[model samples]
Target: MLTINVAFLLAVIVLVRLRRRTEARSRSDERFTVVIVLALGVLIAPTPVGEGIFDLLGQLASGITGASR
Candidate 1:
């Protein structure tokens, strides 16, 4: 029996799609990529890795705001 993780599959797809030349992608292709990436985000958002990313981004945002003030 083979078990595949969907999030892992989507991440691979996103990477492959992004590696293509920008000029090679039509508008619809680009939109499809965006949808895939968004789906990947939703899949990742509840995991510990996602929470860590959120914390890191929050720290960076606060640091920028603090510097500006």
Candidate 2:
């Protein structure tokens, strides 16, 4: 749920920034960004590579929590 919410926030930020700028772009720009953002989501997900990162962070978090911190 939080992940979806964060994605929404990021999408809004992307749209808002693009909206604030004054420039003309081809349709491809929009399409490309859509694809790129989707790829970013996959990359951020807990795939093989991402899982290691998540595990490391989880360890850090457990340490910080220190038995119900």
Candidate 3:
């Protein structure tokens, strides 16, 4: 039996979609890409990788604020 992870598949799709030339994308194409990205975020948010990303972003935000002050 072979099972593919949906999040990984979506990530691949997002990569492929983004690789196209920016000038070639229409408004609807951009909207579709946004929807795909949001879906990917939702699928990944409960996993350990998502928690790590959250921590990393938090630290980055704090560092930026500290540097500004």
Candidate 4:
């Protein structure tokens, strides 16, 4: 049995979208890319990579907040 990792697929989609020329993408194309990137984030949020990202973001946020005080 082969399991398809959705996050992997989404990452590929993101990469492909990023490789395209920015000037060639229309508004709808930009919206679709946003949707795909959001979906990719959702798909990745349950895994170890997600945890690392969360941790990194937390640290960055804390640093920013701390610096402001």
Judging by TM-score against the true structure, name the best candidate: 3
Global CA lDDT of candidate 4, please? 0.95
Shift of residue 47 alpha carbon in model 3, Å: 0.4
Cα-based lDDT for every prediction: 0.95, 0.68, 0.99, 0.95
Q: Mind giving the per-residue lDDT tens digits that candidate 2 earns over 1-69?
A: 334655556666567647744466567877776775786567567566567878898999998899775
Models 1 onward score TM values of: 0.94, 0.36, 0.98, 0.85
- Candidate 4 lDDT trough over 10 residues, lowest sum: 4-13
**lDDT at 52 for candidate 2?**
84
User: What are the per-residue Cα lDDT tens digits for candidate 4 across 33-66?
Assistant: 9999999999889899999999999999999999
Choose the strongest candidate by lDDT.
Answer: 3
Q: Which ten residues in a row have the lowest lDDT in candidate 1?
A: 43-52
Predicted candidate 3 versus true structure: per-residue lDDT over 1-69, tens digit per residue: 999999999999999999999999999999999999999999999999998999999999999999999
* Model 1 lDDT tens row, 1-69: 999989999999999999999999999999999999999999999999989999999999999999999
Q: What would you estimate as the lDDT of candidate 1?
A: 0.95
Model 3: per-residue Cα lDDT at residue 27? 100
Clashing pairs in 1: none
